[model samples]
Target: MSAVLDKPRAKAKPKAAKSALQTRLDAIFSNLKLGQEKLQLAHQSVEMTDPGEAAEVLLRTVIEDMLPASIAPMRREPLARADVDAAYTGMFPALAAMEGVIALSIGQVIEATLREAFAHLDAANAWMDFTEMGDVLPHREDITEADRSDNDLAARQPAAAETENVAGCIFDAYERTIEAFAILDSRVSDMNSGAAYGARSLVKVAVDATSAADETNTRDNCEHASCALHEAIEVLTLVTDEAPDLAAEGALALLVLAKQLLDDNVGALP
Candidate 1:
């Protein structure tokens, strides 16, 4: 009887260990950490020195945020070509221009502007990533196909519908960010063109205004033009604010960036 009791006790320890492993596996399967991980990865990816690295990170983030949880269960694509094309179109040009400016500019002013622009881009990307992730987590398969499938499916089954809606909102935010970047790029181009004819040096830029009235006009026009870039950024900021899933730190990063660019350019105006 003692021998049998000892054998059962030894077997019980193995069963307990097996049960613990199963419990851990269940916890992992039910975990909601994917969303957190996606955002964190997006943040880190943006910090990379290489533009290619940054771009890869951005692309991976978008895919991760958009992908459904159970790939084997649902055979649908995560993102449409049109949506992917639009997103790339919006971000790539500005990203390239930022890289160019970083290479070209020698002084502190350019460095500061470059820093601000990248910071804003990173923030905007992170916010979008978060919002998109909010959409398709719990009922991952059904929620992601919301745009493609019937409204009845989405409306009748409301498990992850809110998450899908949040994803849509995130897409909209990125669109607005694209618009803001366009505005900034165009404005900067105009400024460079204007500068080409106006003055070569800071002293010359300042001295170009012969009288107080001339100085006022030059400052007013250039400053307003430069400030308009920030106005666009402010509108983008508002769009981000409208998103319920927006990260607060990400939003603040954008504001800090916009203010820095506006102040730098406006201050440089003669």
Candidate 2:
């Protein structure tokens, strides 16, 4: 029995190397990848053949690929509005020299956008005026007159319609403005957040009001318009909050640009 045991039962054949599946799994794991050895650099050049197209791509990147929230720097601590005014005041000339007609055209479109923005304010005013009339009892004059009447919110309705046009123009302006920057081989990333928000606000008004007016009645249009204007106002206020340093400056710059394209004249609030 001791000799037989020592013989190891004729060498209990060396345990099978491994199951086929086990061998394959081990092979796969041996070559499996977990992490990159190094980060690859992105292309330095813009990919679009057209500069305008390139700009559209870049602006979208700004609008969509926002900096991580952890590092975003927008603030609202009462910065002087003058800072915005001053920034573009001096930068326009430099930009104009570098970007030429493209720059000027962007300014003009932006000017139009601003006026369109103002028009919405007027619409908001009209809507407010109409609503403020609030529950006045019909006078004895109502009994005497067969057809004496004033259209309710008539002025306000058209005011809202105007935003539809502005919305179209402002959307174009954003495209052109960034296109101009691309031509100059410059970046407008800093302005992207505020601009996108502001433009979207105005666009929301334009689209909401236009669609409702087209499909529904004037009263419905007014409701939509009012809501849109409120949203836009809030957006603009947020822009002021986020870009206090450049808000006034940007407005003033656009004003100068607008004046240049709109008319060659001067006026003051003395």
* Best model number under TM-score: 2
Per-prediction TM-score:
0.21, 0.23
How far residue 29's Cα lies from its native spot in candidate 2, in Å, is 86
Q: Which tens-of-lDDT digit does each residue in 87-173 have in candidate 2?
A: 223333322221222222244333333233223322322222212333332332342233232222432354355344533333333
lDDT of each: 0.35, 0.31
lDDT of 1: 0.35
lDDT of 2 at 165: 52
Tell me each candidate's RMSD, in Å, in order. 16.9, 27.1
lDDT of 1 by residue, 205-231 (tens): 222222221234344643443344344
